[model samples]
Target: MSGTLHLAQALSNRRRRGRKKDFRDAERLVKRLVSQELTLSFVPDGEHRLWRTLTRTRYQRTRDKVRLQNQLEALLEEAHINLSSLVSDLLGASARRRCMR
Candidate 1:
């Protein structure tokens, strides 16, 4: 029984490590996509104003925000990091501190 428990724990640890690696890869991919998209959207065309407005509007839409949030959640699941908690910690510690105080 004790041996079985130890084996299970080891397997869980390995799975957790794999998940973390996968999350890191996913996050990198998402960041790359965002950067590429932004680059394309910002190129100075005669329609630059239109593109800017569309990009800002897309990001502002609830549906779009939810989609991005879901993507981040999926990535965080793999990394074993709670996205909300991480954001809270960052906001709690940084420039927000100055504003809050």
Candidate 2:
């Protein structure tokens, strides 16, 4: 799919008009790949793919952790519980016991 638009444009007979979006998308992909901003492969590379998957998973988990921390902080605020002000880790043993009660 890389450089698909450029190839399509270059190969087009010009006997018919094609969708603008298609050409635009292809152009974007080509530019990104050419600029090395985007990485792609037509053949499967197991180790590379796995590394990519692992990084993506780690990123998603980090985002989830941040979201949960924000929600927890908001809930504590709503309940007038200022655990964060007292402890560095609000979900740690000390804060958890207070929250449970």
Which candidate number maximizes TM-score?
Answer: 2
Q: Specify the poorest-scoring 10-residue window by lDDT in model 1.
A: 3-12
- Total backbone clashes of candidate 1, pairs 3 or more residues apart or in separate chains: 0
For this target, which candidate reaches the highest lDDT against the unseen true structure?
A: 2
Off by over 4 Å in 1: 1-60, 86-101
Sliding window of 10 residues with minimal summed lDDT for model 2: 5-14
Superposition TM-score, candidate 1 onto the true structure: 0.25
Q: TM-score of model 2 relative to the true fold? A: 0.54
Candidate 2, number of clashes: 0
lDDT of 2 by residue, 21-98 (tens): 777766766666577655343544689889989999999999999899989999989999788998788768988877
- Which pairs of residues collide in model 2? none
CA lDDT for candidate 2 = 0.71
Every candidate's lDDT: 0.53, 0.71
Q: Give Cα distance to truth, residue 21, candidate 1, Å.
A: 70
